[model samples]
Target: MSAGTPERTPTPGQPRRASVPEFGHGMVVGKFYPPHAGHHALIAAAAARCATVTVVVAPSRRESIPLDLRLDWLREVHADTPWVRFVGRYDDHPVDYADPAIWDAHCVVFREAVGPGPVDAVFSSEAYGAELAHRFDAVPVAVDPDRRTVPVSGTAVRADPAGSWRFLSPPVRAWFVRRVVVVGAESTGTTTMAAALAAHYGTSWVPEYGRELTAHKLARLRERSPGASVFDVRWDSDDFRAVVREQQAAEDAAARSSGPLLICDTDARATAVWEERYLGSASPQVRAAARRPALYLLTDDRGVPFDDDGLRDGEHLRSWMTERFRAELAGSGVPVVELTGSHTARLARAVEACDALLAAGWSLADPIATPHTN
Candidate 1:
């Protein structure tokens, strides 16, 4: 049942035999588009009954997510299930369930791909799938089409991504939530670096969640005190504290909504850094809002170009800014990987550092030294 062994072919004159459990093989086919809770339930159920489970992931044109992303989602969700094997539906074979010949051909290809083993059963959701399994001479284990018992489907999960994410198993949710929040200080290329990291890793990047919170707080303040100054409204009010909490929740929600990874432009810690530096001290609530990131990426101020975003203090003060932020972070005992060089060079270094950290079994919270390459 392991990946490399060859399957035994039945003799030409012999009858097709019912697969023996001793041979230890099973095949499960589904679209598995992002592999929601229902898919996991079915796979786990099937895996319990069989010695080996070959998951045939059929590509769907209607779904927006890429095939590889779906596969990664499956891998992340089923990391503990060593008996599970993954394979793509053959491109040469048609996906239509009505085509019995095509299904048979796909079965042959799957059997060959997994090495020669007697396939004892086929686990699926659709009626057409049951028919195809019968045609392949395997016992058809039909998963509930409505998934009413499991009560989660990929379509419904996709429709309300954030809300429906609670339906996923804990491991899947954890994997997703950790991949998003990329935190850094102002003028350290948080926005640029977030976008670049997302592109490099092929994942979604959430823009600064705090912007909306800030805007909302400003709006509420304007309503309360029409003539208040921008600083007075933002810095000297309870509204700022509310905005900080709101921003943190939004970032966590964004992480739960997407898979692969979500690169966040800034986090609550970045907001706190500015609040303390400019306002002398953050409000008690704002101070409480500042929390350590899953992975803290510190960028050195090597005089990278800065644009006037109305909020930027310009490149001249970057060294001072970097020093203050570094001191603030150091006191918290949170480890940081300081990225240096040109923007592109820094980004490349960050990626390498992250990869190495992950390879060495370090999670986001674990402190790791930033690697420097000549």
Candidate 2:
């Protein structure tokens, strides 16, 4: 027996009833190109009206975000909706009705995705809702075709992910990794600032992966060779590549599961810095990934007390490293937000830059273009 109490079969040639929520079962079909807040709202509204709502994600081979990712994302966003089931088909199907065969194929796929059910109503915010509903012997409920209330779409997000970032949930945002990188020399508070900024925004953050590796290397050296202090190999090219790879891993993992704004303590670029420091050159992969973020927070060591964590090269190399970072940024064309003064002041300054980006609809394509600061 179906979970929804089945109604009697219609009389011969009689039309099946068309009321949606009033009939206990409802359904919604969407591509959810990237699954933004607007999609969530639509799902929420449908779930509210029906006793049980089965959401069928439109499948396609041409999508940049894969169908599985979309399905997983939908599951995460609607996890609390036990009454709402998510479904999808894996094959070469149409995301848009580009060809005549798509309509027939899609109808078949839709039915397959929503098998063994008497869905009373079909919900959508597009013109095709009526046709889709008609095919299923259900009523059509168009929620918001205009997109006024939740003014966002997958196309707009794909074009400018950073700009449309505010519309995306963490799962969607994670795929893009709109990085806000805090970087500078030793004792410049890069680690401290990244944590504070993440906390300020109530978001997740990527810690300094290189620093973690350095700790491990130091520990192993001590265990193998007693009283041996040097852990300089941590900055070697091969090891730096490891740092870059692991840093990328942490960043990748954090991006798919973090809030709208994902913060990075330091990024692959830092590996390039270590490369130059030890070997007078940078790794190819690390150098490539060293592109500027939505914002480059270059920390200034001036007037700030330099408290060396045993790994730091003391207050001596602070100025040199700061200059190296500046020189690195000099060519990237990325707008720099130079942070100075006490931690509190720097945090406030960073917030100013971040707030302006959010206000301007932070674009993932060119995050730092619309520069703002005091």
Query: Residues 200-296, candidate 1, lDDT per residue (tens digit)?
Result: 7654567875555555666777798887444554444354565576676666665544433456665556666666655666666676677665566
lDDT of 1 at 169: 48
lDDT of candidates 1 onward, in order: 0.59, 0.73
262-357 per-residue lDDT for model 2 (tens digits): 788877776687678877889687787765577788899887788857666547878988998888877777778899998899999998887776
What is the Cα-based TM-score of model 2?
0.64
Clashes per prediction?
3, 7
List TM-score per model, in order. Answer: 0.48, 0.64
Worst-scoring 10-residue span by lDDT in model 2:
1-10
